[model samples]
Target: MKFYKISKDSGKKIFHFNSNFIMSRVIQTDKTTNIGCMHLEEGGVIGYHQAVVPQLLLVIAGEGYVRNDKDEYFKVQSGDAVFWEKDEWHETKSDKGLTAIVIESVELNPSLFMPLKK
Candidate 1:
């Protein structure tokens, strides 16, 4: 699994029309892709499982913990993005709550567009 940052801190500023805003580029896929929004309520958990395809999870709100095959959990919050390889074991959970955007595909190469988390 790999972790990255997609927050405004890593985005480009747009000054179009005299308006200013930061746009974070997440990913681009030429192959079949699946995108969805995930909402984990307080004490919610996405049980450990093998990823059907390469998966990327972008935290848009709240905070949570993510674990890989080693079963060690790491804290994740808004602006964070987690990437799991095909068939990789992983899980996500939150004690309070969290919201995220999930992207799944075989052509994902986030390193081309996102900055890796330190």
Candidate 2:
């Protein structure tokens, strides 16, 4: 079994992320799963982008808003969880500073589903 402790200062700032935001990668698995943390200061914004793989964002502290490609906005706070499908366009912002955990697959297509046919 493995253990991890994630703190605001745990990892390094993610490359290519918005300057107003801080992202740190906590762990990466051989199976291509990545776990990270992000910090968004007041007025910080992560511009619209699409993830190549499914992503799960769990808010651990503070408050923020997430916007989808359709321009729908959702408020999030500590203990809130958000999931984004692969290739889904989304963005995030914080008005009161926010911290969150991000988990995603590194594979191009990690999920599979089969449709039932008649």
Task: List TM-scores for all candidates, in order.
Answer: 0.74, 0.77
Clashes of each: 0, 0
lDDT of 1 at 15: 46
Q: Model 2 reaches what TM-score against the true structure?
A: 0.77
* Candidate 2 lDDT, 1-118, residue by residue in tens: 9876666576565436444677777888899898888988788777788977888788899999997788778898997877788999888889899999888975533235322222
Best by lDDT: 1
The parts of candidate 2 lying over 4 Å away from their true place are 1-5, 14-19, 106-118
Query: What's the lDDT for residue 7 in model 1?
Result: 54
Instruction: Give a tens-digit lDDT track for model 1, residues 1-118.
Output: 9997755466555443332334455665566787666666687677777899999999999999999899689999999999999999888888988777889999888999999999
> What is candidate 1's local distance difference test score?
0.80
Model 1 Cα RMSD, 1 decimal: 12.3
TM-score of candidate 1 on Cα atoms, chains taken together: 0.74
Q: Give the root-mean-square deviation of each candidate in angstroms.
A: 12.3, 5.7
